[model samples]
Target: MNIRTMPVVAVLAFAASCSAFAADSIKIGVSGPYTGGSSPMGASMRDGVRLAAAEINAKGGILGRKIELVERDDQAQNDRGVQVAQELINKEHVVATVGYINTGVSLASQRFYEEARIPVINNVSTGSLVTKQFLPPEFPDNYIFRNAANDTIQSAMIVREAIDVNKYTKVAILADSTNYGQLGREDLEKALAAKNIKPVAVEKFNVKDVDMTAQLLKAKEAGAQAILTYAIGPELAQIANGMEKLGWKVPMIGSWTLSMANFIDNAGKNGEGARMPQTFIQEPNTPKRKAFIAAYQQAYNPPNGRIPSPVSAAQGYDSMYILAAAIKQAGDTDGVKIRQALENLQEKVDGVVTTYDHPYTHDDHEAITMNMVVMGQVKDGHVVYANAADKANAVREKASGKAKK
Candidate 1:
């Protein structure tokens, strides 16, 4: 028989025969920044996902199937993310897809997956607008599921910390004009209003702007005792630098975005004392977290390069497993079924960040919520717990309230 006339099973065996993972080969897709201003996050996310897939394979795979990751570089562009997502769905025939950590990229490609019936497990995009805009009629399948906490839950947690715990009364709001920033600011506003608290000063800036001294000065002049901001790593660092230069010292709190390793290193000593919520903290090593950190450190050191943010890696790692779990639950590997399985997931997975419980649902696409958020302060260039007692209180509040229930 001619080689071209070989049976489909023979062809698959020939393709995977060399690797010895023939009977249990499963393909999945991961798309992210890969290149661009956000490459640090993208690359880290990629490493995490790859690491998880490796571990999964080492353990005899999932349900007798070995996982194969098909990576696509979106370069942080939503349009590109959409194109790449389609490619993964149509060409690669991926069972499920994860990533597009940037909110813009996630938002741009969300509808594409919905139409194609491909489920996406978003690792890090936190813009609440995604959960709002692309729901029900827009995407009946609600194919979008996230491994990160939503802006609303994070905002509510931050407000509670600033008011009830930190006793911060005159907060100044500084947010960039991006989807994540805008959504976080709106959520903050609503949360504060519920507590009958008002901000002392509200300042806005574009994400690309370098100088925030004027805004910091305005907040200082307004007697702002605490600063709550919504912006990316670079801009957040710039704000911290500007605040120090202006000799303005105040309690700082904001979204989990600031916990990224780059933010602290870029901000230098000024970044110390900055309190931010985080889903994963790389300290006080649990066996699982320690193993993950060691593998990542090994993978990207010496002969390898350093990863920009370990948190992104954790996000990517967790997101992949969740997608895999959903795929397994669906059994057939059809996108629509996998998406529904993701929405109705019930089993708990021990993610690098934390153990996520019922990480997804139909009414709520936000996987990690307020209760999963932990407060960390940048100390000695490392993110450490901020007053263990206070952290406990915040977690308790999140649990007792809407977050856990």
Candidate 2:
């Protein structure tokens, strides 16, 4: 109950006095950075998972077994993620694990799950290669699945908004030095290359670094029309704040991390007009979304009534339901059976993000795609639909959850 420095959570404590129920409970691992700069995304993701697990447990649970979440705070560090992965797999003996907010941590830690055939659904991490690490032919059997939109989809959308919509000819790339940033930067470059455009300036900075004057000045000198970013919340705020200091104002287009509360709150009005691709916004465009928003608001009572990272929370919520459906379909908690069931889900999971119907396949592990993503712009204080049409058509699109393009 005491929310301390790292916010360690042992969610979903069921009736422990009942020895039979305790033995019948299903153990699942939830790993992410519950503290530090990345906590906005990580904590939001874990909370969403908690909501889903509580709902499932209340409804006679999955396969009549209560869902027990074994939580771990990875602290947004790669080495810590590796250690957590091992503990979750070995000591905790989790059937499946969910939540990986950082790409570097996902890459470093997911291998242990792969080795154990334990399903690890990356609820937040969007590195292009996160799901491709254990593809067929190379590894025969793969254990990774992702519900979040990958960098390939996000980078392409970022370029489309930058080049096609805004018609910006000269842009600058500023990405963090972490695996998430560098890999996303590469994806952005590839996306730009497809349009035969190269950035005027490409700069890199480390996480928690406040000063971005050097990077912004270089982009300013190059007459860059906009700044393309691939980084997390806190540092991203610095870019906007730094630009204000140099009196250089330009459109900030970047990955979904631009929507994080840390960036939006820290950058203040400076963060306004920033655009990024998002799978789920805070808006309740559908019935499921309305209920989710209301439930999350009532349970967490987050500041300003906004989930810290709405996309992360929504995707995390959907991932839990999807995984639960797989467990039920598999008729057992065996890791291999759950993995097989996930590859071919029989039921339609009515999730906050989308109505997932057989969302994954043996050949493809990614559940969300580019068509499900829409450009969200920071206006006033929160993210709003960049185009009203996207919101108007949300119900029909989400109902089917099919790829249009």
Best by TM-score: 2
Clashes of each: 0, 0
Q: What are the RMSDs of all candidates, in order?
A: 7.0, 4.2
Candidate 1 runs further than 4 Å off: 1-25, 62-65, 137-139, 302-307, 389-405
**TM-score against native, each model:** 0.85, 0.94
lDDT of each: 0.74, 0.89
Model 1 per-residue lDDT tens digits across residues 1-405: 211132334323332442454544787888888775577788888878876776666565666787777778998776788899889888877777888777777777877777777777788788877756567775565777777777777888789889988888889999988766777898898989999999988888986688999899989998988899888788888889888888877877998767766677789888888887777776525666666676666555512233476668888988877777777777767777787788777666777776666666787777765666777787877777876754443322113234544
Which digits, one per residue and each the tens of the lDDT, describe model 2 over residues 173-291?
Answer: 99999999999999999999999999999999999898999999999999999999999999999999999999889999999999999999999999999999999889987878887
Which RMSD does model 1 reach against the true structure? 7.0
Clashing pairs in 1: none
> Which prediction has the highest lDDT against the true structure?
2
Model 1 scores a C-alpha lDDT of: 0.74
